[model samples]
Target: MRAPEREYDSDPASHAHSQTRTLSSSPPPKTNGYVANGHGSPINGSSKHLKSPVARVELPGSTIYDDSYIDREEYIRLVIQSLRDIGYIESAATLEAESGYVMETSRVAEFRRCILDGTWSEAEGALGHLGVGEDDGLWEAKFLISQQKYLEYLEMGKITMALHVLRNELAPLHMDPELLHPLSSLIMCTDSADLRQKAGWDGAHGSSRRRLLVNLQSYIPSSLMIPPRRFVTLLDQARLHQISHCIYHNAPVTPQHFSLYADHTCDTDLFPRITTTILQVHTDEVWSLEWSHNGKFLASASKDKSVIVWSVGPNSNPDIYVHLHLQDHQFPVGCLAWSLDDTILLSSCEQLIKMWNTESGALIRTIEAHTEPVSALAWVPDGSGFISASQDRKINLWGSDGKQRDSWGITATRIIDLAVTPDYTRLVAIGESAKDPILPPPRSDATAASGANRNGNNNTATSSPRTLEYLMIVYDLTTKQPELSVSLGGQLTSVKISSDSQYALVNHAPDEIHLWDLFTGRLARKYTGQRQGRHIIRSCFGGVDGNFVVSGSEDGNVYVWHRDRAILLDVLTGHGSGSVNSVAWNPRNTQMFASCSDDCTIRLWEPSAGDRDGDSSTRLAHRTADDRSHEGEPNVKGKGRSRESWVEDDSASRSL
Candidate 1:
């Protein structure tokens, strides 16, 4: 069998950095205290993770509620009636768990209302957590311990901590209506199997499985940011020729929403398609996408707990989404990484991480890996252990068995992103911290901020400090500890490291990209002026060729950039909304790029030899021979030529 290709390119130390300088003749950017923002600012602040501990509610013992203390059986009658009013019965059974799944004051009220309105069944694992009525003689007061732990995190802001909360310390216990309050353990169930399973046996998903606790739409308020208008405007101008580049040249949009160009000509197209076949995730915003080795399949984890594994082929259509429903994680699937031999997919959410069989999608193992939300996941290039960054302000390395091989955390705020080295020797993580106005620190000055730049959607708006500075973290996986830390001097959003793992690309508040060196922890190269394209949305570089990068913006245009020269390659205009979400390269071919956006389509692009612009080499030659020809004129970048088309899911709307 053929060995698999690593996600990382060959090491940068081994390769020559001077190679980038060669392909692009333009001068590298001048260093400045301020990172440039492309367009304007937005209102949403970067989410901060804060862990909140579970507040223990003291309950009275049996003696405190005795009839001798009460007036009569009347008090008992009243207590039973109140429970019934909240959908709790005089008999055993009926509790539902959610973000506020506990049988509490407000939750009970909500449960009562939901039951009356017929909206109660939608509650996750309600029937199991509520327990069943078996003969009404004996009751099992079991509780989905993980769900309660999640609630504790929600209350404590563990999700806010950016670290995942682990469920290992506490044993896996199924939900039972009787198991309402902690420290009040009761053998409430008469079921032989439920008791037997609880007494003896290892806890795993398939047999005695319980649902994972997850908090979707969970939010915390922070400061928003903006980019600059000049850059956005410049990118807007470059967008006009983008569709032409994609159609004829088949260039992918860099994160800057530009086509990869050296001087004025398009670079060798990279990131092409192995097949045109597409797979539908159970939901939108497929937060994570990874291709398994052998290139025969793709594993995608969604905000929907379901992980869909799709068979790869151009015209081959089999199971589009193999819905692997693991009762392990109840939260939206945030990050996924497969083991080297392609056995397990380590998926993380709020406080827990699980290992699943790639082929079956079943939860084979579970690990309560972090104290907060697991923000980022990275597989070691060597396929040994993997690294994860969490809101808990830490980075952790773990083995496939869910064991913590090593762990590290910063006193700094939340760790939002993580990147691992090729040999799995180093890891890079990025996160934001509050800018304490009084304490002066490392960055040159406040003017160093790139937050003023927006994506053209915002006219002119400045946001508040609920948003503060973000940090770029570097971890030495070999040392098993943090290597270096740098402040972006602004709130960071997304971070991308080069394939060579030498340079780190950062996207901050507003619209700006920082190309920083991994060794010195200093900004080396910076590119400004790519924003929401004419019709596209998001754009950035680090394409397949390891030369130039591409980006698709909300403006509905794709831009290719080589050093300072920003060029519009080709534009495919069919997205009704004039907005895009993400653009990516074909891992196999550098030439073909793909992008998906709010427009509900995935468009592919490549340069064509015969670009219908009528300014062909032959046309130019013919024009040069005639005195009346326009040979001396600069080839106008665009003449309305396009070869772009979209591959869409016909069943998307219908399936909905």
Candidate 2:
């Protein structure tokens, strides 16, 4: 797979050293006999100060930076801990002394020492002084200490002492009975070796005591006991924030690739703009698309009543091919859903939903529950069942065998699309209260025949004022009941929930995608830039952490926006004159994405050659050769474009 663009000075080791340059050269800023108030803002004359003696020397009157969020003493202590963690023992001690900010309180330090020495009673006694109140926190700490004490007694073959600790000490703590049952069984051990093996303990003399200390620290506040590797944790959080905010961050982050010398930002070229391959198995406009959970296969439903599952290559070659061509549906396929295991697929053709074995392309079963056209399909997270929404105003739950399990509910309007959250907590659907005036409504067989016989008097040919009342209904999947309903105004196309289940992106006509916060049940933001006043244009959540939103536009361009900021980042153009219908990003491969269009093709995309690794020349040459090899072949079912069209790079016109 292709990697993102990186700076020339990419030596992480050099960057690591550079990050510490300021730290190694400067001592903590000396306090001027002043300290921060309760709010951490500096006050005159030491109104408040840290418990550490080092705090008197090094902690500034204010935060580390003038506008810094962290308190001054806390920052110093974190630095001191960081210094100790990186083998700067003397430096850590010096900073602790100069800063007057002890990494831990004397009582907390003694608590750590007692735990490490296996002096269980002293450790247990020190818990109160370490600032853990007499509550569940205190009880939990005592339980941990007593548990360790009992385990050590067992390890030393002191069965009677172990029994006494377990019954009198651990039992009296009123802890979970489940926790004590296992310890009670340790009494039957033949010897210390048996006890250690069965308990999965390395013994009290090993790292057990130290591990206990770490566990006990959770009950103590940071002010009393510094969290281990506090400095490293802070840096990691900062780096993660940067990566999440970087609009073009597509590559996996690693120690070798991540650097603290500068904030992380990837080049726009890494956002999968360049079209690398064209899939032409479908004979008509590709209407729907979905990537299997594993990203190994991409399934596209087309207007020709066919579904094509394209097998994606492994990372090294990064190629794609036709894996299965299912032509069983007699009507145009509208939507698709892949089972969590990627072994089963559900494709909807009008009112009938067909389940197929993805591997063999055999129709498993056909579901005939929906009376109207099935608008969308979503599989339950466990893959044991699936959900089908229809214009019949009902959502039905079905088992893997295609038997209807239950109906969510009948809404008052037509359901356009629906999605179950990743956590399986809620089901969100886009419903329109009335037929949209701008778009033609679906007609039944009888209605179509009557309209055909009515000559020019058919009401279907008339246009009216737009009066679509778009709304989203959120259902509690567990109870199969509506939890929240949000009324929106638009010609709704589709809806996709974020991986976190916190936000839903609802595609709307007249060129907009409204992002709704599920928790607040409100519209959070609107993303626009692509033309989607008409036609069904589908958008998706993609990129790292699903931080980017991508959509197809009637203007024949793929629009990308940062999900959080509602900022348009890139407009990718490569499809022919037809409107881009839908887009899907490879869930497992962040560097690759696919866009299907009314042009009767699906285009695979990746980072530009300049920003990526591999033999691009050879890859492109192979693709050109592949396209040429299909020349002169019959264009099946009016697929429109010839195979030779794939070799021509029209990106120059499509790209900005």
Candidate 3:
């Protein structure tokens, strides 16, 4: 027998009493004339109380709410049109029926179907029915349709019919001679392959047919078909423009709320080109260069014992001119550093360190910093003091007041180079360990008889053998204790710490730059392909996120390598016949960087305006060559035209 359905009272008090009575196994509570059914429908009949208990169904916590901000009909219509445009035919049809909004008119649908199926007459009739008269756009659309029909006939081996369609349908339309001539010449094609090759068309099928339909849609009015998302497209373009102009814009703009979708565009031309403006004022080999934090001034030191600071103007007028020439150093300035405030410049020459006010070009202070030549200098993170390393086997910390605050010595070694971490937590030093002293051989008796020896012992001391053990040591600045000491093979020339202080780039002799993990003390990577013999070539890390390492090469080129993969990206030439001493990337600009060479010039590198203006063929060839060169092995020098030749070519073209 079927169980009687249970009903409940509509009043809350009566329902509570009924549940209480059922749970206590007492008689059921009497209900009013009206009772509530399972779906909350009122039933006007006697209640059929259940003899057994019933389980109550709990509703989900989430509730459905109506959106009143946007017009529901317009939004649904747009969604349906988008679905149809993207080929969700069944969903679009169902949505159109349910929403009672027609996304596409019958005439537009017929026109699209005819275009896709190569029914030229039907498609042309539909265009006429939609009021696409013999205007310029309609003519072009008709020409494309007629041309597709001709190609379809040719593919089916209907030569006579194909010729007929071309002469009767296509030739009548006043199209460009360049296009019409090509279509007319396809009549001589005997087979489908010949037509495909000669005409450069895939013969009116698949993507080609779909392309025709899209073209036809463009000529049709929005009232005949579905309108495009013009507002959304414009918003997307504005977002992209803002990002391209603002250097600090790192986050991508995505659709939110009312803006359902948008094409997020970014300027991907991040790498600088080879063509650059060469700053040619320095008289001798440029040794070191640095970009100030604000990117307004570039300070460069040269072997002529002079430092020239160049002021680069704003983008509206990007004129570069010499701002100051500091000639105080008696010897060649080998290194340069700018204070955190960009008001002071520190230059190193031999054992002397000079601090100069950048604006007045006055020497602020001079300190005989070391007993031996100072190899490296770095300012502390807070800019309160600085540190310098010397060949005297010592690392000295000095305050801004020109007083030595603390001094620490590395045992049995002369410091060759040093780099301090950005956080001021540690210091890395590279040097050669000192060897034990050796005594000279005893002098002969004849020399003693001739009284040639000044000493009575008649013996001289000889130099010990050259030390081959190169040491790389890390020290804790807070505790002033040795953290890591490892032996390396070749002589250390230069060292640099990453901005994040996570890795250190150390240049070892004969042509190698090692990337060492600071935390684990493991060799993370090695960048090669640069000539490095006796020259002190410096390597640094820079890029959008410090993903690339750039170094000066003795071969008169700058080599760039990817940090993660250690792959050589480019070997930029044109620094003349001398070694590129230093390469400094602008801290504020990714597209602009500077390279100083022994040729006595600093070249400012940026994206070439001509590159973006080149012809399509030229740009394609350039991009292809770049891609192939960076794929497998590093490109050898002399494989392409030298930068000198490229510059000369550019000059010749400009003359024309």
Report the number of clashing residue pairs per model. 124, 8, 0
Candidate 3 residue spans exceeding 4 A from truth? 1-269, 314-318, 410-412, 437-464, 610-656
Error of 1 at 357 (Å): 1.5
The regions of model 2 sitting more than 4 angstroms off are: 1-76, 83-101, 111-224, 314-318, 434-442, 446-468, 617-656
The window of 10 residues in a row where model 1 has the poorest summed lDDT is 216-225
Q: Evaluate residue 10 in candidate 3 and report its C-alpha lDDT on the 0 to 100 scale.
A: 33
TM-score for all models, in order of appearance: 0.44, 0.68, 0.52
Question: Residue 237 in model 1: shift from native, Å?
Answer: 34
Model 1, which residues run further than 4 Å from truth?
Answer: 1-281, 314-329, 436-467, 480-483, 529-544, 551-560, 563-583, 592-656
Tens-digit lDDT string for candidate 2 (163-194): 89988999998988898898888888889889
Write down the lDDT that model 1 would get.
0.42
Global CA lDDT computed for model 2:
0.71
Alpha-carbon local distance difference test for all models? 0.42, 0.71, 0.64
- After superposition of all CA atoms, the RMSD between model 3 and the true structure is 31.0
TM-score, predicted candidate 3 vs. hidden true structure: 0.52
lDDT of 2 at 638: 32
lDDT of 3 at 432: 67
